[model samples]
Target: MDWKDAIIAVFAILLLLSIATTYLVYHQQQQTIEVQEAIIEEFISARHIHIETTDSAEPPAFVDRYGRVSSSIVNIIAIRSDTGLGEIGRVLIEITEGDGDVLVNTEPFIKPLVQYSVREAVEVAANFTGTNVSKSDITVSFEINGTVIGGPSAGAAIAVAIIAAMEGEQVRHDVAITGTIEEGGYIGQVAGVFEKAVAAEKGEITIFLVPCGQKQAIYYERQTEEIEIFGFTFTLAYYTPREVDLGEYMAGKMDVIEVATIGEAV
Candidate 1:
């Protein structure tokens, strides 16, 4: 081939490579973002979600690459007790509405990630709740386990929901968190609190939010490990599991308050 033609071919090849590289790099980054967001969204929604639209002088901007957004919401899980006979009762979580303008949308490109369900509390309660030798005499209280990573941790999200309901403020995405909330409203430690904290730091979160009471321990542990708190503010508060009413929590009528005990939330 002529020298001129050969030079042109090389340039064309170089241009194609540049375009392909850019596409691949962007695609990979997008895939990573999608994966992480899915993990967070699934865990939150798997509990209960409350989306609320508030009348504000100025609405909040969209938090992500998604479209212009306004609104805030809480993801929650509800548990019921028939007779205070055991550890917990039946637990149910649904996505409802919350206060504020948090954008809600569906993406057609993302696939749902497969997650493990928390081992039912019933399996753990067989030893605690049997009344008589007869099978019918046995009663069981439903409980949820969220500390087991890769499994559902609606328990933690439920605590946040209760907190939001009491405080009357929507928990936004700006804060990253993870934890397990017990029936007593105590923020129980989880397997990945530190890892999740690191992840949030990597995301440039200004505030590291988690189930309350875990802050001192997490902060202390991070300090010993030489991990920086990343200039993020940490707020920890209890979620009233029992006294916190899901119905009212969803309605946006509840006050933004801290829950002292899970028993009080119900």
Candidate 2:
């Protein structure tokens, strides 16, 4: 072959070799990336899903509004020096589908640790109903009209709300409840049953439920008298020695049902 032709042939061979080398490099890189992706997916699949406690301070668990339930709190009776006997306060509870933790947020209310423990007890009850509470986060909120909700009186009402939210049931608006919830799902006696019952009736609640055996309630009557001292009037308050049994007193006003457990209350 001629020298010029020979040189041209060598150049063509080199060009072909370069093209093949480039193709192989590109193909090998693509394969490496594919293998890396598969390994990553396998690792992800093998990793177990674990639940970590939420952010700083263990903020309350939260649920979405996709499903919701609510319950009415019985009114509590409070005695004021100026006023003798009257229905004073009530509490309202709302629940929704949670995303495994439970957060009970109270607005202008009370119950402290009693309410928290009550929520935990309710969780147990809800789980017994086949609800995957761990897979859900529940939020319980209490609404009151500038009234403080002290003690564990909201146990029964809160339980019903949690169950209704998980099961998507309806809670009667005219029904009110008060009682302390124990860890075993049994309810305990609460204070101020008469006041709570009276408040429920005042709110037009038709069904009022209290803890069983809490048939007697003590309404502490107080007498206040104003006395003039150095141009300023002073008032003194004292409790009266009168205690009344609530079983009969409540019988005539509303449908009072005595429940021993959350299952019975529901």
Model 1: weakest 10-residue lDDT segment is: 131-140
> Model 1 over residues 1-266: C-alpha lDDT tens digits?
98767767886899899999999999999899788868866674564322233444431222222322222333322211232111111222222222311121211111222121221221111112221111111111123332112223334444444234323346654443344444434444443343344444444444544444444322122122223233434454443322232223323322222233333333
**Local accuracy by lDDT, each model:** 0.34, 0.60
- For candidate 2, the clash count comes to 7
Q: Score residue 57 of candidate 1 by CA lDDT.
A: 41
Query: Which candidate achieves the best TM-score against the true structure?
Result: 2
> Between which residue pairs do clashes occur in model 2?
63-98, 75-196, 77-195, 98-137, 99-137, 100-136, 100-137
Which lDDT tens digits does candidate 2 get at residues 220-259?
7779999874455768898875565665676666787888
The alpha-carbon deviation from the true structure for residue 259 of candidate 2, after best TM-score superposition, in angstroms, is 1.6
What TM-score does model 2 achieve against the real structure? 0.59
Tell me the spans in candidate 1 whose CA falls farther than 4 Å from its real position.
1-149, 152-154, 162-168, 210-266
